[model samples]
Target: MKIASFNVNGVNGRLSVLLRWLESARPDVVCLQELKSPDERFPVREIEQAGYGAIWHGQKSWNGVAILARGKAPIETRRGLPGDPDDSHSRYLEAAVRGILVGCLYLPNGNPAPGPKFDYKLRWFGRLEAYAAELMKAEVPAALVGDFNVMPTDLDVYAPQRWRDDALFRPEVRGAYQRLLDHGWTDALRTLHPGERIYTFWKYFRNAFARDAGLRIDHFLLSPAIADRLVAAEVDREARGWEKASDHAPVWIEIADG
Candidate 1:
């Protein structure tokens, strides 16, 4: 089975880009983030016409997430992460697709460190850690996939010194990510291609893409039950080169049928 995660930036604005990739790649399951639209405004028809059924949680002009299952409708599991009833951001969407529990998340980009936004990012990581523990305890085949917004290690970034003070590369943020992996979730890409310089996101500034200066913030963490089935993991680097492309490209993993 092929499963992928992409931060589309804006689902409607990039509908054509997304549809084109879907047609060409034809991933069996896809997790999308950064819809930048409200639930009512999601381009459901366009997605459905492309042969995928989706469930999404959207918020206006900001964070949102969704899951798409090819030739089947994902069984909706949850719309938001547990442990934060007061938190209103639409950043998480979970579903059951083909016996796998898929958790799609758009983690907050805590830019301009030493600020409230950064604090929120840390808090959100705490919430994610808590729920991840629950999922591990459940022992179900699962994959937590999307834009994690953190460079887990210096190797995951093109230039570690440049991002030293940035929230995404902060020591604390990296520690939080490590704690998630400590819960027995395998980092699919790193596991498959250890020591390789792989990246999934590049800023529009300073011709980052042209220079191959990028960050590997998008990720796939599979529970042990499914990690053993991991066959391959990769970044669709060509998608990032397309016109009107998202700053982030698609990352996908192929797993063997048990």
Candidate 2:
């Protein structure tokens, strides 16, 4: 089965691009982030017409997440991350599809660091860590996929020195991500393409995409059970070059069917 993740930026605005990709790529499962729309406004009809059943957690003009299963409906598990009742951003969604538990998330972009936003980002990471531990304990075939918004290492970024002060490349942020991996999640892309510079996102400025100046922020973290089934992983870099495309390209993994 093929599982993929993409940050659409805005589901409705990018509906055409998304539909075209879905029809062409035909992933068995897909996790989408940054819907940037309210619940009532999600283009459910359009998505259904594309031959996928989806469940989405939408927010007004900001963060949102969704999961789509081809030819079937994903059984909804959770709409938001646990442990934060006051948190309102629609950044996390979980579902069960074809016997695998999939968690899709859009981690906060804590820009202009050393402030409240950065603090929130760290706190959110902590919450995610706790919940990830629980998932590990469950020992289910699962994958945590989406735009994590952090560069895991110098190898994952271009010009790491220039991004020293950026929140996405900060030491603390990367350390937090490492701690999560330490809990037994496999970084599928890195594991498959070791020592290679594989990137899923490129900034729109300074001809970043043209120059191939990119960052590997979107990820697929699989549990040991699912990791054992991993067959291939890759980034659809060509999608990023499409007309009116999102800054992020689609990242996907194929696993042996059970």
Candidate 3:
């Protein structure tokens, strides 16, 4: 099955681009981030018409996430991270589709670091780490897929030195990502294309996309039970160049039936 993840930026605003990609790519499952719309306004009709059944957790004009299963409804498994009850960001969602447990997330950007937002980002990462450990223990065929918002290594960045102090490339942030991977999850894309430059996002300014100045922020981390099934992983880089396109393109993987 082909599973994909895309940070749409805004589901409503990018509806056309998203629909166009969906029709062409035809992934079996998709995880979307940054819906930037409220639940009541999630544009369910348009998505359904495109042949996807979806479940979304939305917030007004900010973070949101959704899971879409082609021609089927994903059985809801979880919503929101478990560690914080007061946290209300719509950044995490999970579901069961075709015997795979998929967890979709939008990790915090935490820009302008050395501040509260950055602190929150670290805390959230810790929570994710703890929860991910539990998932490892469950020994289930699962994948944590989404815009993690952190580049795991210098290889994943266009210019590592330029982004050293940036939250996304900062040592602390990158360490957190490595810790998560240490929990026995396979970083699918990197595992397949070990030495290649693969990037999933680009800045709109400074001619980033045109220059191929990008970052590999979106990811598909597979649990050990299904890691061996991973057959292919790639970034749909062309989608990022489309008119009125999102800064992020889609990242996807294909897994052989176990």
The per-residue C-alpha lDDT of model 1 at residue 50 equals: 97
- The whole-model lDDT of each prediction reads 0.94, 0.94, 0.96
TM-score of each: 0.99, 0.99, 0.99
Prediction 1 TM-score vs. true: 0.99
Candidate 3 lDDT over 151-228, as tens digits, reads 999899999989988989889999999987888999999999999999999999999999999999999999999999
Model 1 scores worst on lDDT over the 10 consecutive residues at 76-85
Q: For model 2, which pairs clash?
A: none
Please estimate how well model 2 matches the true structure, expressed as its whole-model Cα lDDT. Answer: 0.94
Tens digit of per-residue lDDT, candidate 2, span 129-216: 9999999998999899999999999999999999999989999899999998999999999999999999999998999999999999
Which one wins by lDDT: 2 or 3? 3
State which candidate has the highest lDDT: 3
Off by over 4 Å in 1: none
Count residue pairs with overlapping backbones in model 2.
0
Model 2 off-target regions past 4 Å? Answer: none
Candidate 2's displacement at residue 76, Å, is 0.4
- Tens digits of per-residue lDDT for model 1, 145-249: 999999999899999999999999999899999999987989999999999999999999999999999999999999999999999999999998898899999
